[model samples]
Target: MAFVGREQELAELAEALQRAAEGEMGRVVLAGSAGIGISSLLDELESRLADVPGIIVARGHATEPRSALPYAVLAEALGDALASLTDEPFKAVVGSAAHDLAALLPAISPRLDALGIGREAPALEAAEQIGSRVAESLRGTLE
Candidate 1:
């Protein structure tokens, strides 16, 4: 079901997408608390874009609590990028990022290891530093 109050927002998103299709770069930032429909809006936008030609969508979600794990979100977003790699050099660079992250956060490391990243050196940092770096990494990955 659609949120009854967000008709204008959806229309504006559609307009921005139309402009982007014509070679314009448009960005939207929705700032609000959880359950305020930001994710839903983003989901709607992505769903609308799915049928458009030449469109690629990469999404990352990092909550404050889960954001402490280094590169937790980047690794998720990069999975598709990593999968698209057939070349050795690009694969090495991106693969190393994935591997290093897995080793850094023990909770996530085993899961990533299951995905084939193995034997990586730990990314040593304090808890606060890890959180800060993870947020930074997420922002960088989005760009």
Candidate 2:
């Protein structure tokens, strides 16, 4: 069944995608209290994007226990996309960003090795800092 009462939200997402198509970068974050229909909204959003070429939708889940794990949600969501990077021309572009990702997602170490990049050492310090390298690497991967 179709969801109603979110035309405004859907329009905003559509506009963001249109800007992205025009080479403009936009970020959208949806947050709300639990059981407020966020998933329904995203399901509708994903359905709407299905007809658009060059669109990839990756969603991460954060359970109460898993939520505390750094980058765990990202690892889950991007597991397939990360695996795809081991092959093709993307291998050349990945370079050291492999280190950045491997720091957060250890399961990709084998994939990184396949790319000849080797495993990234644990990225956290005694203080457990991640900084911006992961974000940059994520952008590189998405681009």
Per-candidate TM-scores read 0.44, 0.70
Model 2, which residues run further than 4 Å from truth? 62-68, 72-75, 80-86, 89-93, 115-130
Q: Which ten residues in a row have the lowest lDDT in candidate 1?
A: 134-143
Clashing pairs in 1: none
Worst 10 residues of 2 by lDDT: 120-129
Off by over 4 Å in 1: 65-143
lDDT of each: 0.56, 0.70
lDDT of 1 by residue, 1-143 (tens): 55567789889877866786787665554566778887887787777777776554545566665745545555555555444434453335435455344444345454455556555544756767655654554344333
Note the residue pairs that clash in candidate 2. none
